[model samples]
Target chain A: DTAVSQTPKYLVTQMGNDKSIKCEQNLGHDTMYWYKQDSKKFLKIMFSYNNKELIINETVPNRFSPKSPDKAHLNLHINSLELGDSAVYFCASSLSGNQETQYFGPGTRLLVL
Target chain B: QQQVKQSPQSLIVQKGGISIINCAYENTAFDYFPWYQQFPGKGPALLIAIRPDVSEKKEGRFTISFNKSAKQFSLHIMDSQPGDSATYFCAANYLGGKLIFGQGTELSVKP
Candidate 1:
């Protein structure tokens, strides 16, 4: 069984299209996060949710939104995707708000043409 | 400013040799430092981690050397193997639920 899992490991979409990536964690955790890894391999935090409540939202564009239906699931929706949106998106979960180890999913490579 | 800086963006080491990667951070508030290893087309997995209170920690052939005063940390792999080839990243974080990652370092273990 996978501790964290993401669907559509690879996604190729055209510009101005909308797409969503789903993530789920089998481990009982209270916090989840979304990170974007660019071509330069720089990983940055985009959003974090604690107990299904949005806690930390970085300077992400309005087109990108994260929804946590429950403590074990977090989904990211991107509207009108742009070429610069091409990157590897990773989902991670921690046991609590902080000071805990994080487990990451395989990742979703999104390519915007 | 780049919060965390990693040196030698890429490295090549002979199998059975030692592999070392260094990292430095600008934020003094970062009390926790972690190192992640990622394979191609895969997400990063936590290889090892250390806190400022400890000078160093070792697990098997992996070791983390932490310097609280210098705001620097490093990862050392003893008896590197071909299967150890991957990208390594150093990250720092405070009590917040966010982590600041350094540009990854690609390590190739030549057999």
Candidate 2:
């Protein structure tokens, strides 16, 4: 079984268009996170949720919003996407808020023109 | 204090050779350090990890050597095979906080 899964493996849209990426984990983890990997392969954490509650929010712009409906799912919605929004979005989950090991999903590639 | 610097943005090695990637951190608060391996079109996966309390940890041919005093850690792949070629990332976090990842090092193992 896929421990962590993400939807829309690829997305291509114009600037100002809104899009959403879905993520789900079946590892029975309590914490889930969203990360962005730029073209340079630099990975950065964007948001984190534990048991459906927001635990960490980085310096990301308001255009990027993360919603966790439960402990198993975390989704990212981007509004007014810009050219700079092009990157690979990844979802990860841990056993708990303090767990050290985090499993990552395949990732969703987004490109804005 | 939040950055993890990695060296040699890219590396090439012959089969059966050793591949090493080094990382340094400025934050003393970081206690958990991990190395992730990522193949093309895939997300990064945890390859190995270590804590400040341990100087070294090894699993199979992959080993992590950490130096708390120097705030540096390195991943050494022994007898590297072509299948081991991938982008490796070093990350650090304190008490389960957000992980600060290094820029990444792409390893290419020649057959």
Candidate 3:
């Protein structure tokens, strides 16, 4: 069974449109995170949720928002996507905030034209 | 600084050769160091990890050598194979802090 899973493996949309990505983990972890990877393959943390509570929100734009309905689910909603928003997004989960290892999902690729 | 610096943005190795990737960190509070392997179109998976207390940790063909005083660590792949071709990332984590990853090293094993 996949430990962490994200829906909409690939998305292509026009600029100024809205999109959302859903992430779910079955590892029974309390901490979940969202990360963005740019064209240069640089990964940066975007947001973090621990036990359905927002903890870390990096220097992301207001158009990007992460919502955690529960401990097992965390979704990202992007409003008015721009050309620069095209990149790969990853979702990960760990047992706790201090867990050494994080299980990652198969990333979602978004393209804005 | 909370950064993990990785060297050799890309590397090519023979099937039986040894591949080495290095990483350095400025944060002394980072207690755990892990190496993650990522294939194309897939997420990164933890391969091996080491703590600051240990100078070296070996698992099968993969080994991690750490230098606490220098705040540097490295990953060594012995007898690398074509199947080992992938991107490798080095990350640092404190006890209660988030993990910071290196730029990443893309390894291509030639058969």
Candidate 4:
């Protein structure tokens, strides 16, 4: 079974369109996270939820919002996407601790024209 | 602010040769260090990790050398195979916080 999964493996939208990416994990982990990987392959943590509580919010703009309905699901919604939004979005999960290894999903590739 | 920095943005190695990737962190608060390997179209996976207390940790052909004094660490793969070719990332975190990743290093193993 796939430990972590994300929907819409590929997304292409217009400059002003809005889009959402869904992520789910079956590892029974308590913490879920959203990451953005740019074209340079630089991975950065955008948001993190520990048991449905927001814990880490980086310097990301307000256009990117992350919602976690429960411990197993975390979704990202982008408002009025722009060209700079093109990148690979990844979801990760880990046990509710600091040093736990994070398991990542295949990733959702987003491109804004 | 780019806490972790990795070197040699890309590398190529012959089969059965050794592959090394190095990383340095500016934040001394980082206590946990890990190396992640990622294949094309796949998410990064943990390959090996080390803590500040230990200077070295080896698992099979993979070894992590950590220099806490210099705030640097490295991953060494022995007898590298073609299948081992992938992008490697080095990360660090303090007190189990959000991980700060380095600019990944793409490793290509040629047969």
**What would the per-residue lDDT of candidate 1 be over residues A5-91, giving only the tens digit for each residue?**
998899999999999999999989889999999988889999989999998899999999999999999999999999999999999
Any runs in candidate 4 off by more than 4 Å, and if so which? none
The interface RMSD values of the models, given in order, are 1.5, 1.3, 1.5, 1.5
Tell me the tens digit of each residue's lDDT in model 3 across B1-111: 989999889999999999999999998999899999999999989999998999999999999999999999999999999999999999998545377889999999999
Candidate 3 chain B has its poorest 10 consecutive residues by lDDT at B92-101
Q: Residue A53's C-alpha lDDT in candidate 2?
A: 94
Worst 10 residues of 3 chain A by lDDT: A95-104
- In candidate 3, which residue pairs clash? none
DockQ of 1: 0.73
lDDT at position A45, candidate 4: 93
lDDT (Cα atoms) of all candidates against the true structure: 0.92, 0.94, 0.93, 0.92
User: Candidate 4 local accuracy as lDDT?
Assistant: 0.92
Among incorrect, acceptable, medium and high, the docking class of model 4 is medium
How many Å off is the CA of B61 in candidate 2? 0.3
Q: Better model by lDDT, 2 or 3? A: 2
Superposing every Cα of model 2 onto the true structure, what RMSD results?
0.9
Q: Per-residue alpha-carbon lDDT of model 3 for A1-113, expressed as tens digits?
A: 98999999999999999999999999999999998988988888888899999878888999999999999999999999999999999999998745778888999999999
